[model samples]
Structures are given as C-alpha cells and as structure tokens.
Target: MSNTVFCKKFQKDMEALDRAPLPGAKGQEILQTVSKQAWQEWQLLQTMMINEKQLNLMLPESRKYVMEQMEKFLNNEPTDKVTGYVSPDDIVEL
Candidate 1:
C-alpha cells in the first residue's frame, strides 16, 4: 500500500514521498508532512527559479535563498514572484 500524508501545502491527505527529498532534519520533516505531488511542483518551481535567476547552487547565498523559498512554498505562503514571465501556453497563437 502507498503511504499518505496530510499535506501541509494542500491541506489535505495525499500520496506521500517514498523517502526524504533532501538531507538533514528539514528533509525528514518534509517526508512526514509534504505530499509527493507538492514536492514535484516545488521541484519544477525551484528549477525555474534557478534558471531564470541564474543562481549558482554552489554559492552559499544562492542555496540559502532556495531553501527559504522551499519553506515558503511548503507553508503555502507567498513565494518569490517570477518577474516578467508568461507561460508559453498563455501566448495566443499568432
């Protein structure tokens, strides 16, 4: 049977991740509270933020910024705004 969690992000029960998504205590906490779906969504957003902002994960400040975003994301708080971005699908076919 698949595991389930009361997702903090969605505020509902959902399928749980098979294991911690990251290391350390924060990862363990996420494993217990975050849903698989929410984690996947965060992964995509994180990638976009890294790419659009040209963040160097090797830098401590960049890593810290991403970590802060992660916490806000999981808590359903307002996250960093993606400036001047429009979804490709949102562009009307010319």
Candidate 2:
C-alpha cells in the first residue's frame, strides 16, 4: 500500500495511516480516504467533544453523535465547537 493518500479533509495528498483506526467499513473508509494528520486532528477533536459534552461511550446515542461529528469533520462541514478550548499552536509563548 502507498504511504500517502489524497486526504479528503485537507483536499490534498498527505501521509496515510498505518492501519485503520476503527473496525469495519467506516474504519476502512477512513483508512483509504483520510490522511494521518486529519485523523490525528479528529482524535483531538473527538477527545475534546467527549470531555466537553460528557459523552458516555457506553451509550449508543453518544457513539452515534460522535460518528456523525466525525463524518461532518472529515467532509469539512461545520461541527460543534469545543468551547473554551484552544490549540497549543495558537498559544503564544513569551
């Protein structure tokens, strides 16, 4: 397999993930279309969403919500923003 993929999110070629992040079709789709950088970004956003929304992964609804968000994110659509959160790169060091 090629080490690069045409990332759907960034709309450019980028490094591909070594393996699918999840199981089944969705994971396979992501592995094929989503770049490693985009996936890593999604992971960060997913963590923030889980923490901010107090999502219980044990619940089907929560998982579904996350999945929906993931789709939107990968498609470059608007998603629920994690309030009060800032990226480390956005932080200015003195």
Candidate 3:
C-alpha cells in the first residue's frame, strides 16, 4: 500500500497511518480510509469526551457510545459535543 490514502474524513489524499490503530475489521477499514491527521484529531476528541462525560470504558454502553461517535466523526457527520470544552485556537492570549 502507498504511504498516502484518500482520507474519508478529509476528503483528500493524506498521510496514512503506519498500521491499523486497532485490531479487527474496523481497524483495517480505518487504516485504508482514515488519514493520520484525522485519526489524531479523533483521539483528542475521544479523550475529551471520555474525560468530560466520565465514561467508564469498562461499561459496554460507554464503549459503544464511543465507537458510534468515532464513526460519526470519521464520516464528518454530527456527533455529540463535549460540553464546557474549549479549543486551544479559541483561547486568546492576553
């Protein structure tokens, strides 16, 4: 496979991940379609969601919710927003 892939999220050719971020078919699908940049952005969003929502990964519901959110995010569809979270770009330096 080439070092680049047509990223589904970004809708353009971008750098691909060195390997699947996870195991199983989902991981392979992401490896083929999701760009490195998109995956990194997803990770940040996932972390914030977990922290802000206090999602317990041990719970099946929590895991499922995250997976659903991941799919929506990768597809550039609407997903649940993290409340009270601020983007670094939005923060102005005094």
Q: Report lDDT (CA) for all predictions.
A: 0.94, 0.96, 0.96
Q: In candidate 3, what are the lDDT values of residues 1-94, reduced to their tens digit?
A: 6599999999999999999998999999999999999999999999999999999999999999999999999999999999889888999999
Task: Extract clashing residue pairs from model 1.
Answer: none
| Index of the highest-TM-score prediction | 3
Residue-by-residue lDDT tens digits, candidate 2, 1-94: 5599999999999999999999999889999999999999999999999999999999999999999999999999999999979878999999
What's the number of clashes in each of the models?
Answer: 0, 0, 0
lDDT of 3 at 17: 95
Candidate number that wins on lDDT, 1 or 2: 2
Per-model TM against the reference: 0.89, 0.90, 0.92
TM-score of 2: 0.90
Instruction: For candidate 1, write residues 21-71 as lDDT tens digits.
Output: 999998999999999999999998998899989999999999999999999
**Per-residue lDDT value at 76 in model 1:** 92
Worst 10 residues of 2 by lDDT: 82-91
Model 3 quality (TM-score) = 0.92
